[model samples]
Target: MRTLLVSLLSISCLHAIDHGPYIQWFQDPCHEAEIRWVDRSGFQAKEGEWSRGRGGFGYGDNDDQTVLNGMQNKYTIVSIRKKITLAAPANADDELIVEALYDDGFVLYIDGKEVLRKNSTGADAELEAPGGHEAKAWEKFSLGKIASSLKTGSIVAMQGVNDKLDSSDFSLDIRLSIKGKTSTDLITRSDSWEYLVNQIPEKDWRTSTSLPDAVPWKADAQYTLGYRPVGNGEMTWTSANSHLFARTESKVFSVSLKGLKADTRYEFSIRNESTKEISGPHLMQTAPETFRPMHFVIGGDMFHTLPLLDAMNIRCGQEAPLFAALIGDHAYTNNGNPDRWYQWIDSWVTHCRAKDGRLIPMVMGIGNHEVAGGGFFPENNTPTPDKADEFYTLFRMSSEGSRVISRYAVDFGNYLSFILLDSGHTEAISRQVPFLAQSSANRKKTPFLFAAYHRPAWGSGCKDDAVDIQQKWCPIFEKNGVDAVFEHDHHTYKRTWPLTAGKRDDANGIPYLGDGAWGVAVRNPSKAELQKRPWIAKQAPINHLIRVTLAKDGFTCDALTADGKTFDSGTYPLRK
Candidate 1:
């Protein structure tokens, strides 16, 4: 079967295409990049005795460059520049099969930005300073997986391959292969429609505009711990809920812990592990074990709109709720650049200051923009589960062993359970049924139930609704006697009367609120339509965050405008 598959691929193969070993060399071994221009002369500058080009260069003990630091020569560092020009931007899903064969640690920079590394630890200077051999063999990597924005035209890529100023051997070999200057809509799923890749300008953390420093917000129960450290490092954290207080030699962080004490507070932080440099002694309080009034902010479509995110953050901070549940579109972080997501998140962490000093916890759900197909980072105008794993690496949602942290339940207290749904960005609607049914069925006497997902089952903007969700999850919600269902995606805002089987039924139907307007622009419902249609309880075209207050027997929710004024409100009565 495998042979047959290969034969079919070979038979249907249209062509084999790849471009460029484009090259140039610099001798400075940039200690720092900005304000250190050597000019683009296409030749070597003679400062002392340094040069460029390919060669079997080796140094003996005491060579000036090698011994410059005990170091011999001054040009121990050199950069190979490859100016790859694409007639058209490569497809977002397209990958340049980078072939790298080198000695010592090296750093790669695309255009001028340093994309998150490949199998590397530490910073570029350290990597460029020397000591990497694992990638010495020809190893293939993908460019799209590293860069956030890859577009048409010329791209200047450079890599600094290092050897200790006194090392015996050093070499540099790198290349990129992809469907260059061509369009290829990346497929979203095996049977789903395709979409385009995002083509915004790339951001260089070194120079990209940064927000003024605000108080940093700590990670919550569902927070993502960056990456597992490579070599010797400590992964340290503490959880009052779980009675956890320890440091591990290995730096692999986890999220969504079990056995945590309800209603207790926990303190945690992220460190360099090696440096013991800490991010926080910040605190996060767990949901209470008993029923009580709880406050939380709900919003979505936060597509890098810093001001909107800022307003929401500050507003939520002022409200100082138990947590913030963001439905989706946190940031349009494409090309596997987790930093893109973190940077936007950083904006919130810093600016979203509470009246009191406490880290606001977060509950998250992935939207279409968050995924490739759902809309956000479409490559070659395509979407793919192929690279959506990047989202998972940064967040640890409630899904225990699932790649898509789209669905799961978080207990707010004995009385309320937020059952989060994965609206088929990467996972199928059908596949989520088992989990939905299971979570809905086992309520543990928690009468107040709320549900959240990205796309609304009934919206007023685009398509007005999602049949997939209506069919797949609505029945389950109804069976479970859900108090209210929160959803976002259409960028418009609307609340439906209690709905059951797609129609408004006041007696036993589930109410649907939110068409999602957190950071994205507003698409208010047509005013005429609002009057003509009675199914919609209320509708508005504005950027607002919803606030929900839950008590033992009931709950109240209100949509608050950017400046923190209530525009829409609803109350769900006690469950029978």
Candidate 2:
């Protein structure tokens, strides 16, 4: 009888694990859709003329009442597009439902096919042409003949809304409420595995043109010893099913958990020993000592914004990454104050999770904003006691015997190696270069190697350069075959074609990937500014988290949006 009961519970767990398909939710016809907008200044706009600006909240129960009044200035016109895909064909009589809040007029198109034009006047002849608009809010439009429209790959529903030329305040907010069947999502961690492994289906994980080998792992081995690495200090760990308190004043501080079966999945929670307050029942996985297949998310510059922060947390849930390589600038409070730092730290630990309620663990790096004396104001070239104390206090550092918790390296068996550097925040670049060089030289033949810092050496037109990094670290990264250097703090997205000495040399060079947009909903870099850096192969002005994976075949990196889709992806071959 007991055996039968156990089998039933196991079946229930397996059934619960399949959230949906292996890829991100392509469409949810029942719920309101997500909108991507591009604003154009003049009436005469070209198809490729609009810049990709980032900042759109998803719609749900309050979607119809959603207000998008971010603009206080009266603008000329706004163009937007929403990509909707269906898993199965819709009925021929199905309709495309949309509600809008516009100042002047609007034009709508599904799959580039013109559906309706309301109040559009003056020079709006072509379907792609912009027109003058009129004031309207909560205007509903149910256009028929959209139920079975299928484009080659994906369907685009475009809308061009115009604002009154003389209006004092301008804003355009719209929602596409479609009724149809849509492709859905399946969480990666499969419960069918007796061992820990990332279960992907049909090699279609990217959901885009890029084919990145999304490696999950099979860690059937055990640590043997009970001691596991958690935070700066070591702690003995059991499984997440039980509570293990840190032997400190705060019983619930972050600590590295060691001594578990390799490639295993576990859920953990933190409890304040004194108050009995609990923080998480969050999920996590262990690193396999061998290169089975693994991926991790990395970025920085959170700046304490809730929406953007939620985006990072949301992506973590979707990707279910092994760990996040956080390269600094989380929470804009740079000034050294205990209360401010504590507030930021509290927020960071509480959020930052995967879509399936997995709490993320960060492999941290120190950015200028991470310290007390560095910011838009003056910067001290040296480290102080309070600068990165909060970070050090909140997380574990595997710095070996060194005192510099700000910089360290973690070895995931022979599979991967990471040189997490301090980038002049806690230690001057000149001082940390020797250690970086030594570490790089030793790991020259590793299958996958990465170096991370807070600032950029070859950024996209902004203060992307860190003189010390350009002269000191760049030489080492280029010479030692560092696959890529993860960087942040510029608040824009960028990827360089293999670079050597600040120039693109694709033949033999290191690609600098970042301009952290994790939680900062800052504006995208102007097109003009983006053109200034000829070395940048790709750039996105959106908040994102970067995922790099060491697959069975090669190495892959993708800039994933908050919605669990790959905005841009690149895969690299391993060195001989």
Candidate 3:
């Protein structure tokens, strides 16, 4: 009786484990499917199974006897057929998380390293077993790892093994999510180059193509190339002599130009391709031969408020920086629709043009709002099918169709490198921890370093509660000598005193800035909470934007509120 009860319990567990949705099967080892099966005995069935009663059941009865009276024992190998395609920006740090449910056991591999292993058994086994011999089952296992080192077009795969005696009765289910660097690297030297330029009318510019000149600039005119000499500085344009045409859908136009120097600087201007409305009286410097100073804007949690965008536009215009880094929460809610995203893009394109009419480039990191609303509890929500399919497509990144190479380093004169990380709505921080450690070594090339993400590591505001950042990401930052970290999420202004491990506020420690106040309302941090956390250097109830100016002496950071008030200013000296 005791033996029978034990067997019954085992069978019951197996049955429970097997009772979930079915994942497709795959034959290629590199495919991103969750289940795979190989049949050894040549027994064929739509689904697989064998009946114990067919051969008459008895204590310790062998189901093989029924199959082998004149036949041979059969084994069915099952595997997942679906694949996970990671969308990562070129050269950016990223991670991939794969979750699967299967019968028996599973082995996960990324670039062929076994990352996770799991086995399941029980009374439920009988219920899931083929013909009631001894069923095998497993369910829901998660595996995560950094994708930074992965090459473009690399494949990720998962394999499952079941010890069932029959060639039939196999099942599995699998899903995947990725975070970080969804945009492809646009600065690479290649022939197939597409340019998206913004042409504001009255802003003198010239173009290669002659279309019925759109909104901003007119068509067909003799545009002049303006120049001025200042000090010993040489004027150069990063992009010049490009074909220009306005984009019908978006507010920006595109220019494609070639025949220029590599790692060299030249100044050029654009006039209406047709109207000859010369748009540039300004100058841009090209990438350096080695390492040069690269500048970009960082902020997040912006709702579709035009006023906030206007402020940012004005500041950015005055600053006239290179790129913009948005730490997620782009649209109000739901990553399902493209309307909000498009609107946001249109607004930026319209207002944030350079003096020469170039639309500022954008690099985005995922946020809770970019995924399914709140990011902490992600399992309950699945990406809407169509939206999920289109999300990566709209963004110009190598995050689709088996590409690897997430997490990019923008080398600004080999002295400063900005590492953009993804911290929400996808994989957990733990997976990318190792990559963060490795990134520290880059300080040798770029002595000044910083990291940007969507969520804050430390917070004093009531809404600033992100446990994952404190636990998983903080240590990496501290260990890496990351000069500072910029984060968004909470809608107020706060800065951390160079901190180590959330508490020790050492001058050498990593400082954290932000709580995303782009367009969001501000909430003050209480005195009691502020007192408890000494790492907070300054906390205020204001909506603001941060600007960093890098020079040979040191870098200066200014936190300016929307109304152009300089709330805080600090400088980070270059490390010896």
Candidate 4:
């Protein structure tokens, strides 16, 4: 009975994982469809007319599983259909929830019946997609009491429309989930083995990725020790099942361990069931929950120049900071190429470590190059989350579940806080202001308050400031007493004299500490170029990371090169 129950539980757990496929068809501009028939059951697409891929289908957004080739200038619509074959009929009280990540407009149909419409017009065959829409995070719509409509073989179809045929990008993807009695998620952890071995020494897990089935682990765990590293690892962990949180992307999974003491260190390991391979017994420490003495590394624009980045990564690891704030421009993988990310992660996993061998937890913000169609930020246009799909998937902290809201705040036990902003990559700069204001205001009392983003509002390399950021967010930082602001993307080193209202005011100014020259080719501005920008207190064409230490009295920052040389240092007292 026990064996059968375990087997059944394992099957149930596997079935609950939601990484499935959908059939997609990008509309042809030369011969557009005059009728919409794919939404109905038994509607078979003509041979070679449709392609199958995971959710998220579209063009130019790099993250799309099914790229609508040549659709940017030729067509403005793509239709996606998924067949739901539930094992049994849904209960009358069961709730059906549909989550969608879309851009411009879309119309949803269930078994050929119109169900929901968003930013779109017309009906069935005449559906029109006028441009000028920005895709945000996942939006949820409820099909209340429509349990009977969810019968087996029913087709859930969506037509994703672009605002214009020449628009920069378009995307649409969805998930149909049911919630009700007997719909409990299978919470059981699998991959069980009898004996627990701690044989493998702590090494970078990227080698584990080479193990055919080895899943690369990110530094996102909170505390609980016993856990499975995504991709079918043994569940012979010591912690209870309740503490394990499973996150899935395609077939690979990431298990987050929760409910552990803060600022404490723990050892963990994973065993591969397929190869009988043992890996880890590695160390990870939870972020501090209270104020004492702590330090962290901060920089951005990495991976373009490999050797420089690797050097900086090694030097950063030696700092033994609590974490590294690698804001943006990672890999320069402009169009969602997996190989670019693979190399970047490999280097990070190998070199970005603490002196004591702890993998440095990374906190990041999105940048222009992260988008699929690189540097598409027009003053009036907004991009979608689909543009930077890999960034969200590659880093756990940058997103909430599968939904990536690019702006978020992380607080450390009332003493320190970081407000990470997305500088018009996945979200608009204006839209982030309210969040920036609220986050800054809430952290006013924090002993060490900092804001980090990819673009510099007042840049020395660039001709002008990010007008939107300067007009909207800089005031909030000054008003809320932010001690410092870390800015990046110019490929040069910079430190500004504390300024308020666009001028130096040492008594009431927030220091802008970076122009982001981590691993990218440094931009050397001559004295003539330097003389053009009066906001700079110090500027150099050098690659370095800022190491900051916080104490009860105040904090200090040191700019260090990859070879471990401190070229610049400053001490700042807490703002009262």
Give the per-residue Cα lDDT of candidate 1 at 569: 90
lDDT (Cα, tens digit) per residue for candidate 4, span 491-566: 8888988889878988888889888889998887777766777888888888999999997788888899998888
RMSD of each: 19.5, 23.2, 26.6, 20.0
Which stretch of 10 consecutive residues in model 4 shows the poorest summed lDDT?
Answer: 33-42
lDDT of 3 at 83: 18
3 versus 4: better lDDT goes to: 4
> Candidate order by TM-score, highest to lowest?
4, 1, 2, 3
Model 1 Cα shift for residue 5 (angstroms): 61
Runs with alpha carbons beyond 4 Å of true place in candidate 4: 1-252, 397-403, 526-528
lDDT tens readout by residue for model 3, 1-576: 433432343243222111111111111111111111111111111122211111110111121101121111333233211112335433334555554544445544445555665563221112122222232322334333454555543434333344554434333334444544453321111111111111111211111112222222112222223222322355333322212111111112222223323233233333333333343332333333343454556677776576776677556645556555666676664555443454454455445555544334455565667654455543234333223222333332223246422244454455556676656445446655666677666563456788877767687655656677688777776666778788888787778887777775666677788778776766777788778777778887777777776666667677876666789876777763
Candidate 1 local lDDT, residue 507: 81
Tens-place lDDT per residue, model 2, 237-286, is 33222111111111112233334555555544333333333333334455
Name the weakest run of 10 consecutive residues (lDDT summed) in model 3: 50-59
Runs in model 3 lying further than 4 Å from the true structure: 1-285, 289-295, 378-391, 398-406
Candidate 1, after superposition: displacement of residue 142 in Å?
24
Better of 2 and 4 by TM-score: 4
Q: Of the candidates shown, which would achieve the greatest lDDT relative to the real structure? A: 4
After the best TM-score superposition of candidate 2, give how far the Cα of residue 376 lies from its true spot, in angstroms.
Answer: 7.8
- Candidate number that wins on TM-score, 1 or 2: 1
